[model samples]
Target: MSNTQQLKDLTTQVRRDILRMVHKVNSGHPGGSLGCAEFFVSLYSDILDRKEGFDMDGIGEDLFFLSNGHISPVYYSVLARSGYFPVKELSTFRLINSRLQGHPTTHDNLPGIRIASGSLGQGMSVALGAAQTKKLNNDSHLIYSLHGDGELQEGQNWEAIMYAAGNKVDNIISTIDLNGQQIDGSTDTVLPMGSIKGKFEAFGWTVVEINEGNDIDAILKGMAEAKSKTGKGKPVCVLLKTVMGNGVDFMMHTHAWHGKAPNDEQLANGLVQNPETLGDY
Candidate 1:
């Protein structure tokens, strides 16, 4: 298969993983997880220059932090499929004493998780610190992070934005998942934070826009462009416009499924939309 087709297949399987994981638990975030399947698949499969194994102290290799940790289903699925851990462990997600909690946590020492996220607005600061550390150590690898657009409402993100630009933390590429929908409602209805691209540019970061965040080809091209823009005296930002629930027809473009699990019938329907490519765990 061609590279793009391979990525697309992986994305479809990841979407299936997301739906099955949440449905099995009857709890967990599926909307955002489904929406970001392409991003996760493309990043881990093609973009990152990762080493053979996982380590908390990720030195001399690309690192990624999931700011919107509610979508642990996708993160765990991608990491597992990428060989960070066994894919069978996905069946235990959200179960008591399972390393795969509803949201990612460091307390359990999950192999691929570097930080306990999902608290919102804190991941950028943590990524910045790591980026700065790479700079100090003369490490040349980059740091990447993903944040929900709604999460920008937190004051801490802006502070980190300002800090990164002012201090020239150019080794980080932060992306905002501009799905335009949050838990309560559309971001415009909940709390309209105007012009994410404008705000990032004003903060002195180089910004790129991906109008089709769900498309693997678009993500690959946009991320490559973002990488080219790095090391130019500022951090980079990718404004990714994505649908809340992308692969499943019924779930697409709605916030209702933000944290809801599918029933048996719904799960079956969703799986039909994305045929199992890598086999289900």
Candidate 2:
């Protein structure tokens, strides 16, 4: 199969893994996971450098951070599928003694994750720190981070943005899952972020908007454009417009499924939408 075909299959498999893992745990976030699967798949399968396995300092290679780590299901699935670990281990998600927890942490020394997250807004700071350190070391690889739209409410992210722009941390490409709905409800209803693109531009960051969050080809194009925007003395932010529950019909367009695991029936139905192109974990 072509690399593009492989990425499509990997993304479908990751979505299936997310559904099954979340269903088995009976408690985990799925909405955002489903929404970001394509972006993660495209990055891990096609864009990122994985010459070394889970290196903290991904020296001479690209790196990624999950700022919105509550979407651990998608991260874990992508990591496993990308050869960071055994895919079967996905079944241990959220179980006792499992390396996979409700949230991700580096304490477990998990093969793929480099930092602890899920406290919200802290990942951006962590990412900024990593980027700055890379600069100090004269590394050329770029750093990538993903954050939830709702998580922007945390003040720490803005501080990190300010720091990155002020210090000219230009090799970082961050993404916000602009899926509108959060666990509480619609993001606008919860706390409106008027003109997000304008806000980031005002903060001195280059911004790109991906109109189709679930389309892998579109995401790839947007990411390439986002990368080009980097290294011009500004951090790049991609406002990814995604559906809260992108693939599953019942779960879409609402915050009700944000943190709820599907029952067996729901899982069965959701799998039909994603299909098992690369086989479920």
Candidate 3:
């Protein structure tokens, strides 16, 4: 798993899984999920200091909360492939009574999911709470969370941002997927939040920017730096610049795929681009 090439291959396969998962049910978000493939693969395969099994309270292990839960395709794929569940369970995505809901839910007590997330802007608050809980328990493992750049429009996230800095939640690493696109057109068309790095710095966070987010090697290196910044008296924030629909040419650089699944032809096209690096689920 430490091999960068192996992780990149997994990233390609995760993209295949995202495309196929969304296309199978004609539901779910694919843009952000595709954009975050490298992050998820890099985190689970190379970065996280995790235990061998799943539990609600992840003591002595690093934790991850998907703030933008709509990207459940990537989350679910990585979790299953990483042994949180059977990889074949992915076929049940978005089906009634399935653990893989449109957005991740804990009602099924799905392994590797601590909080239900597609409700944008709440993940930071949840992740911060977990970070603080680790502090209270005298646990040194870091807490990680990902947020959509567009989701920053939510007032609750800003409040959480302020609280994290003010409370000195140094045991957490919050990464913003700065894809600049959301469900409704580009983020600028919706609401422009200027200078994310400046905002985080002004709020007293140590920020790291990963300009090449889709590259697994860059992610591993940048996340390592982010992890090293932990316990240094300030929370770390990684601004990961990514393409909305990264691996698929037709889907790239547009918000149309944000919440839309590819059609049969589009799915075939995307699969061709990604290839089945690791066998399909």
Candidate 4:
């Protein structure tokens, strides 16, 4: 990975990309995207033992799945910035026929996107398949996945959870963004998912809690620990605590911006806060 400062700078730039992409379309999700900027940056920049280019097979490289596909802005920004595709292509986000859809899909043949997401709760099962395949192939590579905390209410995740533990799918690490805020409202108010860690532990999976999901250093440290636990006997889950709409002062601490775009004035404010790092698309 790049130095800590470089990773931070990329994160700031990714935030800018998310804001601009959503503002340009007057649509899309920015809250979750902004909240996960640091994790995306850290993962693509340094963490993954990724190969030179993109391919669906992933063969010997680490694979990542975005269960909460509404956050395509963040995912696209990171993939583009990481050279999976042209950074300039980020300008076409959400436009008709654009590879960068509001939700990720494979039909577009977009690099770095393995499966369609956004239905919520199905990502764990997909990651498990990949992990199990890796193990069968005797490949040491790991599979990583991210899910929205609110998305866990889907029930399908729990089934996958039980399946992973029971089948010993230990080569995968799934991180849940515990931002607490979701589209409808705060997760606590909308649907309380009591004791996510306990639930995972009870299912026989190893758990790693990242208290500062928005911090590069903290995420790197926590993820490193999670990586070490792979190949043991159970899957690993990361309870990542993040803040919705991080970096943008107004967007923070609320679910209002979950799928809303910033207007001209709000966009100006957001850009000013993130500044220009690595230049705009």
Candidate 5:
């Protein structure tokens, strides 16, 4: 069993990692990365049935794909802390020739990253294909994927969504980081996506809503419920409502910080708000 306090502590630490990784490089996306800290921490720490080490062929264990790969800081941090690689490697984030890039890439052969994302709308297709492969091999383990709500603007997602449900890709759970704010502005201002839940249901999916995407308890329960809904002849979609830049008071509720790295003073302030719970890498 995973302890709530421990999960919370890990979240705080992951937030710290996101902030520091972005601040160090003076580049990379921090807003979405910060927003999804809780989900990433909970997924790695308590949700996915992971194996002992990393491999390209994940046969028996659950696999996770990040479609919105700009938020690579949180993903990299969680993978490292989960023992996929040395936590110290986080310092190389966005640095020249580093495995960690502005967006996740398989070119570096990063242990935890299975696919190169950030083009948007393509992750769903890749994940669906992987889920299908799992089924073919008779592996009962599930496949999990995360996408930015804004990425839905791409027409490819709808096609994938349609395909997943039409074929009954029941071994996958796809979660949307429904933080209303995207890069240019609020999703409504940039481009409003009407009723994600309704859309998924219309596409023939089992949908669940997590009202508090930042809360560890909510993520744990929501994910458990999502797991239960799988393999019932429909893919599961989780509408995770999150506040962009969740941990830092100054960064919350705005799209301005989406890809902007914090300055030294700003970084210090953010660090104060999320004091290190697990040691910084």
Candidate 6:
């Protein structure tokens, strides 16, 4: 299959897995998971090298970190479907003793996940630190990190951002899910991220805005641009404008469903909009 088609198929399977896993556990943040499905698909399909399996230190391989752990559904699903673990393990999500916790953690020794990140705002620093380590070791591999727009409220992120720019941490690419909605309500109502692009630019980092973050083609294009900007002596940040719940209408336009799993009826309805491309996990 072509890279484009493969990414689309991966996204479909990811959406299916997200629904089934969340429905089984009766909890999860499907809204963000759905919103970022295409982004993750493009990352796993077009970027990153995992043929030798993932390592915590990730020597000689690109690394990725999830700052917003509530969206673990998409991360776990992508990792499983991309061959990081047995796809069947998805069924054990959120169950006691399951490595796939409600939030991702390295303690479980999950192959793909490198750090625990439910606290938010910390992953950027972690990614930056990891990138610095790679540079220190003279490794050419890049580091990637994902952050929710709301997570920017944490003071640590700004410190990390400043540190990255000041210290020339150019090998890290940080993408923010700027869906304009968090767990509470509209981002503006909760904490207005006024001129996010300007804020990043002012921080001395190269910034790119992706208006169609939910579309696979657009996501690929945006990520390609992000990759191009890497190693240019400045950190890159892509401000992704995504809908809270992208594929399903009822779940869109609000934050009420941000962390709520769909009931049986809702799951059935959502799955209707997204066909099972690689079979449900």
Q: Write the per-residue lDDT of candidate 5 for residues 6-75, one digit (tens) a residue.
A: 9999999999999999999899999999999999999999999999998999999999999999999999
TM-scores for all candidates: the values are: 0.99, 0.97, 0.98, 0.99, 0.99, 0.97
- Mind giving the per-residue lDDT tens digits that candidate 2 earns over 1-281? 12777888887888899899989979999999988989999988876755757677788888899999899999999999888989999999999999998999887778999998989989999888888888888988899999999999999989998998998999999999999988789999999989889989999999999999888888989999999888999999999999988778998888998999999999999988887887666
Candidate 6 positional error at 166, Å: 0.6
- Report lDDT per candidate: 0.94, 0.89, 0.93, 0.94, 0.95, 0.88
Ranked by lDDT, top first: 5, 4, 1, 3, 2, 6
- Candidate 3, run of 10 with poorest lDDT: 1-10
lDDT of 1 at 208: 94
Off by over 4 Å in 4: none
lDDT of 6 by residue, 1-281 (tens): 24778788788888888888899989988999989999888888776654567767788888989999999999999999888999999999999999999999989898898889898789999999899999999998889889999999899999998999999899998999998888788889998879888988999999987999988788778877888998999999999999887887888878988999899999999899889888877
Model 6 clashing residue pairs (backbone): none
Model 6 residue 173 CA deviation (Å) reads 0.5
Clashing pairs in 3: none
Clashes by residue pair, model 4: 1-46
In candidate 1, which residue ranges exceed 4 Å CA deviation? Answer: none
Worst 10 residues of 4 by lDDT: 1-10
Clashes of each: 0, 0, 0, 1, 0, 0
lDDT by residue (147-231, candidate 4, tens digit) is 9999999999999999999999989999999999987899999998899899999999999999989999999999999999998
Q: What lDDT is obtained when candidate 6 is compared to the true structure?
A: 0.88
Candidate 2 least-lDDT 10 residues: 46-55
